[model samples]
Target: MDLLDDDELERSAVVANCRMNRERGLLGSNGYDRELGFNPLDVLRKPSGESRPAGWLDLCCGSGKALIEAARIVHDEGMDVEIVGVDLAGLFRRVDPDQDRLRLVEASLGDWRPDRGFDLISCVHGLHYVGDKLALIARAASWLTEDGLFVASLDLHNLKIADASPLGRRIAAALRRAGLEYDRRRRLVSCRGRKAVDLPYRYLGADDRAGPNYTGQPAVDSYYADA
Candidate 1:
């Protein structure tokens, strides 16, 4: 429907609405109500053997699910970790007020500047909505400490243009205008480095498992760069 044709502000609003609707549906349906389901704590725990008390940032942390998960990981590991959740929408209100461990900030990722770099920065299911993928990655890279981790998850389903669908072609053209490119075969791609990485995709819903409705092999790619 060329939601972004109006303006950047309108585009952000459209993306935000899509995210809110999908999140409400998913949570209401109990589609991910299991213990730590869809949370990154379980994923982060695997490689962080005995890593103590590190700072974590959850960029575009919608509804603060990942922020809560990061908080749990810090508490359980007894690590002196501080968790920060930032998003364009005020979705942080959905988080419990009693959880002092998590701090939520209402700001676009492009405008936010943290005082200190984090040990780990996560952009789960939020990278695709950004207007400038490379610039965002560079900004994210700037906010990382040495050897800090940056985890991003992008959906491939919305990155393609089908001849049969006018909407799809419009989306593809918009992405081209933005100078972004994506591969649809890989469902999810993760980039970690001190320098900016070029990763691309389309704006799906706020959840990793939502939108584009295409199923493919999930992939995670990691890289190390000096700060």
Candidate 2:
């Protein structure tokens, strides 16, 4: 359901929930847990010929506390890594304006594109407010280096076409064909390799009047024209 415009967002609510999301144990890389099967250090271990520093990128990063904590841990352990967090929120907490490693950006994910590739990228529960989730996923996948991970939490039922027809099954099949894995139980979509993908539908804009989503939070609904 749509309760926010593309240019306007529920930043305060999202930032507030970010703390809850972390407490609920949804922030995968928090304080580095190997049991979670996610290790940001692994991104550094992977061989890379690129000149840019190996790093992590977070979409809708909110207060960016997770990344900040990660930087502190890496610093204490003497690891070299940078973090870039992008969110539409006007201001973020726990942000050191002068901090060099963890960079926080304020902008819509739809318009914010990084100039470099990343080894690990995540969007924890950020898709709930996106108008074109599929479009973002496709672009996000392209921003990863080979073996780089692109993980995003997505709700299948939250997506629909212009006519309000549920395309959950059809979209899941499309993701598989595109080399991405959709975990139905977790409501997550992830992939390791980057490949050009073409979906069977064309974006027909979005509806910001739909209402709240399964999480009881304001969300954007995308409408794609059937191919």
Candidate 3:
């Protein structure tokens, strides 16, 4: 799929902007926070103090938060790595300047085609928005080099039969049609790993002891899916 097409890119931007606005309102804040969950860059750090990866791609990288983190890791570790962030909303454009090592492209995860494959690809909290989840996963897989890693997250809470939106229902239907087994009760899956991993769904401002009240909300279940 070619993501650079004008019409698709424009539509994708509109959806992304809407999502960003909704999330901003939910948080009641404009700044991005780091304590949300696991950091991919930190996970990629090596003990030898060497570079992380030759190149990094942040798919559906809204506001460039993850991309910024990756760039900081590269700079602090003195790694010669290139970082590219692709998002439909164009949020990265509004980020502060001095992101020299980072490049933001307006593209849809459902259709983007990078010039070169990446050594590490991250799709954080953005896969469910795509119209075709499996197609998007296939495309991302195609963009990974051998032994490359692909990190993706999906929100099972968003798929609740009671709270799910029409789009979410459609996504669930698609997954069913594709024969992908998903546990609606547990809100978790083991598509990539042998054991099911409990997805962390902590609110941006909520306390840890608050329990999983965030369930049935728009939370992401991250996975290190094979690339």
> lDDT of all the models against the reference?
0.50, 0.70, 0.47
Query: Which of candidates 1 and 3 reaches a greater TM-score?
Result: 1
Please give the ranking of all candidate structures by lDDT, highest first, separated by commas: 2, 1, 3
Assess the local accuracy of residue 173 in candidate 1 as a C-alpha lDDT between 0 and 100.
43
For model 2, the stretches where C-alpha displacement exceeds 4 angstroms are: 1-5, 8-52, 96-99
Best by lDDT: 2
Error of 3 at 32 (Å): 9.9
- What clash count does candidate 1 reach? 1
Q: After superposition, how far is residue 156 of candidate 1 from its true place, in Å?
A: 5.9
Worst 10 residues of 1 by lDDT: 218-227
Q: What lDDT, from 0 to 1, does candidate 1 have?
A: 0.50
Choose the strongest candidate by TM-score: 2
Measured with C-alpha atoms, the lDDT of residue 209 in candidate 2 is 54
lDDT of 3 by residue, 81-139 (tens): 77898877675534445556778887655456888767667665455454434455556
TM-score for candidate 3, residues paired by index: 0.54
Candidate 2 Cα deviation (angstroms), residue 113? 1.4
Report the Cα lDDT for residue 164, model 2. Answer: 87
Candidate 3 residues lying further than 4 Å off, grouped into runs, are: 1-14, 17-37, 46-53, 93-98, 156-227
